[model samples]
Target: MRGKATVLLVSFALFVGGVLALQLERGGVRTTLLVLVFAALGAVAVRQTIRKRKK
Candidate 1:
């Protein structure tokens, strides 16, 4: 389960990096929203991973 979570986190990071690379020119509201959404997802993943570790 931990390994799966790690893979998920890495995949999310890569996806966000790809999005950022594509939006490198004209960043606007959509890019900002995407970043925020991804950040929230990352936070959730981190929280869950920590919770599992404490178990």
Candidate 2:
């Protein structure tokens, strides 16, 4: 149950991100936006790992 929900959430995120990236016309902004998105994703992953380990 949880696994399926997680997969759907991740898929939705990727789909939305791809669409937004395509809509951006400027190269610099697009690159910056991608960097920010990855940074945010990495941060979330790290936070989740730390949380799970503490339990």
Candidate 3:
């Protein structure tokens, strides 16, 4: 529960940051970090969903 909440919050922050970063430019480290952040969030979400179904 706590872990999910933390991931959700962090992902939200990262998304917001990513949007801001996008406003700055089109491609760079910020954009890459944003993509990585989204990928991380997706992985966490899928992992949690799988864990829940296993139980």
- Best-fitting candidate, measured by TM-score? 2
Model 2: per-residue Cα lDDT at residue 46: 78
Predictions in order: lDDT? 0.72, 0.73, 0.78
Q: Per-residue lDDT tens digits of candidate 3, residues 1-55? A: 8977887788788778767767766668867877876887788778878988998
Write candidate 1's Cα lDDT for 1-55 as tens digits.
Answer: 8867786887677677657656666567657766776776787678768978999
lDDT-better candidate, 1 vs 3: 3
lDDT of 3 at 31: 71
Q: Determine the backbone clash count of candidate 1.
A: 0
User: How do all the candidates rank in terms of TM-score, highest first?
Assistant: 2, 3, 1
- Give the alpha carbon lDDT tens digit for every residue of 7-47 in model 2: 55875696578569768997998878777767666766776
RMSD to the hidden true structure, all candidates = 4.1, 3.4, 2.2
Give candidate 2 misplaced runs (Cα > 4 Å).
Answer: 1-15
In terms of lDDT, which candidate is strongest? 3
Residue pairs with backbone atoms closer than 3 Å in model 2 (clashes): none
Give me the displacement of residue 3 in model 3, in angstroms: 3.8
Backbone clash count, each prediction separately: 0, 0, 0
